[model samples]
Target: MTAIELTGVTKRFGDVVALRDLDLAVEDGEVFGFLGPNGAGKSTTINLLLDFARPTEGRAEVLGMDAQRRSQEVRRRTGVLPEGFRTYDRLTGRQHVEFAIDSKEANNDPMDVLERVGIAEAADRKVGGYSKGMTQRLALGMAITGEPELLILDEPSTGLDPNGAREMRELVREERDRGATIFFSSHILEQVEAVCDRIGILRGGELVAEDSVSGLREAAGTAQTLEVTVSRADEELVASVRTVEGVSNVTASGDRLSVACDPDAKTRVLERIESEGVTVEDFSTEEASLEELFVSYTTDEQAASEQRGRTSDGKNSEGEDDERTESESESEEVRA
Candidate 1:
């Protein structure tokens, strides 16, 4: 079943359009990555799902209900970590999570949630004293108060240290394993590349690409990085492998060779190496990274967004102001 679905969703703020004829779907029980540069309608799409704002045209559905019409019910089953949420400063971490549990009408032990987010020791500390990473963890703990079916996380790794970011990625996987659908958004391409089963990239308020990482590499005709551990690596082997069609670059070290080539050229690469009297002990092909694929698709649009940002009105071409205040209003809805 699809946990989230949007069809022909166009959101406009007066003369500026934040989204245009967008269509997206995230399957149940999968970690789906939502990617876009600043002002790419990423937040607009999130707002539409939670019914914080209505689409100017078309429809949005979450958990099988009309997002705009059944908003409260939808919010009840969904957990959100918005980009700029303001947590209560005077409250302790535990207090924050307990309040979320109460608001969600859930019977959860606050400490368990805190522990899951790696902030249990600081559970009693006032949020005002917490570091940015710790505060982010606290918000995440609160969002998981009810074991929500859908998790909408916007830049979840913000302020998290390397270790904290890694832990958050693991938590996302755990939640997905427990039957939750995660709509993860982050500028950290590695994090998205690691956790996402599939990705949808938004550009100029439209989804420019949506597919698995491998699918995207194929669609873009990007090269794969092939690492071959050979019994011997020599210039002869390197030069011979380079002669193979589609083999772009070859680098050799002690007993290993790194070859960048087209996916179909992999077999010929190996054959060339073996024919050159080198034993291919082991080999692996790594798909192009999500970052490379992302840049390939959105570089032009990003440049365009920058040019539009210079407009006298100060709104991003993608309508970053696209009613940014709506995000603040939606924060209240999420907290409620």
Candidate 2:
């Protein structure tokens, strides 16, 4: 069974619709990254899963239980490390974990939990004196109190240094290895790309895309970078490559030229550079980064939606003439 599933889920706040008819699912035992910009209803979806808010239409299920009807049960089996997690200033790290353990009626030792999150030495230190990164680790410690079947992490790497961030990734894997499903949501694109097995991107309060990083990159149709090693690199050569029909970015460093262009244009790019008395030594292609894929999917989806809206609004008289001109220009560009 899927660890989490939402079917036709729609949420609204008064007159404002927060989520459309959304259908999403996270398979059991996989780390699923939830991504979106602000005001994208990511928090709203979390609230619905935890029953902090009710969906205006459709169903939400967590661990095979109704999110609204059996919320208590669902939460009991799920562990959450919320965004900007708070702690009592006067309490020690041990005390915080103890509280969480008691609240969950868990048998986990507070010190063991603290140790797992790399805060055992600071177990007795007042949280008021902790660094932001340490505090994040402590909160993550609390979330693992009962070895929950599902883990939901919201910006789990916030305030952590590179080392702590690395540790967080390890711990996430450890939990998954021990049979837990992780729902990781964060704006840290690289971290998400490194850790998540699959991801679902939310845009404008709807799920715009979902897949593994490579899969999404393919679906988004973003350009790949061709790093070509050449005998010589110069300004004239860079400028020549820039005018390639599908080329978007061209840069030179030492004897290498990094060209961002459509897959079909790679041969043309190399030929253009070679034509300029430059010997092509060696070259390699790199996939687009997660960050680039994010922008493309989000912006492209919005652009497509806007175009459909304009078309549906109708074009007549003078407007039709202008539309024809625009279409002709676009077609000519495509043909070129």
- Whole-model lDDT per candidate: 0.82, 0.83
Clashing residue pairs in candidate 1 are: 319-322
Q: Clash pairs of candidate 2?
A: none
Error of 2 at 215 (Å): 2.2
Cα RMSD of predicted structure 2? 7.7
Candidate with best lDDT = 2
lDDT per residue (tens digit) for residues 17-93 in model 2: 99999999999999999998767888888889999899999999999999999999998899988875588999999
- How far residue 123's Cα lies from its native spot in candidate 1, in Å, is 1.3
Candidate 2 clash total? Answer: 0
* Regions more than 4 Å wrong, model 1: 220-288, 301-336
TM-score of candidate 1 on Cα atoms, chains taken together = 0.71
Q: What's the distance in Å from true for residue 127, model 1?
A: 0.6
Name the weakest run of 10 consecutive residues (lDDT summed) in model 2.
308-317
Error of 2 at 13 (Å): 2.0
Worst 10 residues of 1 by lDDT: 308-317
